[model samples]
Target: MLGSIPDLLRLLAVPVFGWAAYRDIETRRVPNRTWAPLAVLGVVLLLWDTYAVVTGPTSGRLFFVQVAISLGFVAPLAYGFWLIGGFGGADAKAFMLVAVLFPAYPTYYLQTTALPLEPSLVGVFSLTILSNTVLAGVVYPLGVAAGNLVRGRFSWAMFLGKPVAVERLPEEYGRLLEDADGFTRSGLDLDALRMYLQWRGASLSELRAAPDAHRNPDSLPADPNPPGDGSVVTDGGVPASGSPDQFGTAGTADPWGAERFLDDVEGSAYGTDPETLRAGLELLADADEVWVSPGIPFLVPMFVGLVAALVYGDVLYALLSALGLA
Candidate 1:
């Protein structure tokens, strides 16, 4: 267990570092106060690592090789991430600290450090594709499964992290950003902005006629409960001339499209805060469910491909006796 301390530290740092970056994106300000402490922590950890190297049970030569090689591996990674805006300054610094903390960050470089340029290049290409495919294949399918199993998965989120919801329709056309009530005098509190669908209708039936009713799929909800007789249609009055039948399209043709037409009926009639709140509440309560994927579900294999250059070196090592990179 003690031997895994560095790995544990590295793993722990990811969420801390990533969440801080996320907060900055949300607030448009990355507070120096939060990062100052992490910077100090990084320094302390690096110093501790150096001290451990000097005093630990490992032989001096073995320790030196590990430290130097690890540093070599991480330097390039840090430089690359720096070149891309994907990592903010704080994120990069924290990443370096994480690399130092684990000691394995650089050691992973051993996979390709000594290979001939040609084979190493091939491995790099292979690994890059592998890693990307792995991440996408893993993250996307997982998100879908999780989305289906858990109805409210992030449903209550108003601003919803980074996915800006569009509420434009026949009445409020092209005014999505203007109509958004996400920002308040107190500033953004993500909970305030649960996703909402609005339609222009004096009565629920007219809402089904909106032209966009069939195209935007994710915006629609699944089958909704039938509305009560004396329903309060959505605010701003429903359109006088629109109804799903006016468009002459079969209601059941597309599940996604059908949901749009249904939302109009639901929202137009049951359009009050209580109705919206009730539906939103029901969805939000389902958040605890875990979405199960429809596959072997292991994502690590994809990551193995991200740095495919390792395979090139591995092949060379196996065939040419070249002690190349990992």
Candidate 2:
């Protein structure tokens, strides 16, 4: 009965992760509230497992060791990934939660065969999930490459992004491949435009319809505390419109309200600076089409990883072992 508790707890993660994957696909944002109840439950489960280990046989101490390794190692690793921008806030939080909830692999039976077909030597369940996630994530790029080949659109950039019409850019998610300098891996993020549109309470079409009205500094409400950094403001005391230079001057056309959006919105414009946003907007306004990378919805692979971890144990470990490397 005590052992069954861990299995049940692990099972509970399946639906939660599935739901999170769905939400990630629909909207890139996931609310912090989504993890609250799960975090509370994980803590309770940890306490229960700790108590069970303390009173149980000496061999059960290994379970405690696994928990320690997960909390001490995987938790910090997840945080570091977030800090380095390798993982989003929600992705990092998801990994941390997995570390807490599944410190050690839970035992289960599949008819005649026992579950976790192959277990990791280190026995940290969250680490196994991460490894599986990485292996599963490779499929997306392979799929993209295959589609590009099938369509006879051959380019080195095929693996990264595909051509997208500039007018349809606002409707798409992901980053643009072309910038002021042309062809960049770390291009402008579309979310910044979405956030700007949301803040202005207007659509991209509305901005494009009356470019002058949106671009004029006096047309919109006055900013009480304008940025004093001089990044958005020009020497002429007006907001810098995207000029012909890298950072455009007020004389340049801004049909997308990029400069006004940067000036009005506080802080870095959705992970990009004011100048880059203006430049990227200028490129978008002038270009007929551009390449855009539809970033992988990481939660889908995470969900797959969770399932694979539970069923197959550490897939990479198994593969390495098969290759005689482990």
Clashes of each: 28, 3
Off by over 4 Å in 1: 1-32, 104-326
lDDT of 1 by residue, 82-195 (tens): 667444454455445434443322222234353212343222222233234345454554554465446544432222112222222212111111112332122211121112
RMSD of each: 17.1, 7.0
Poorest lDDT segment (10 consecutive residues) of candidate 2: 229-238
- How many steric overlaps does candidate 1 have? 28
Give the TM-score of each candidate: 0.32, 0.83
Residue 233, candidate 1: alpha-carbon lDDT:
34
Q: Which number leads on TM-score? A: 2
lDDT of each: 0.36, 0.74
Report the error of model 1 at residue 238, Å.
29
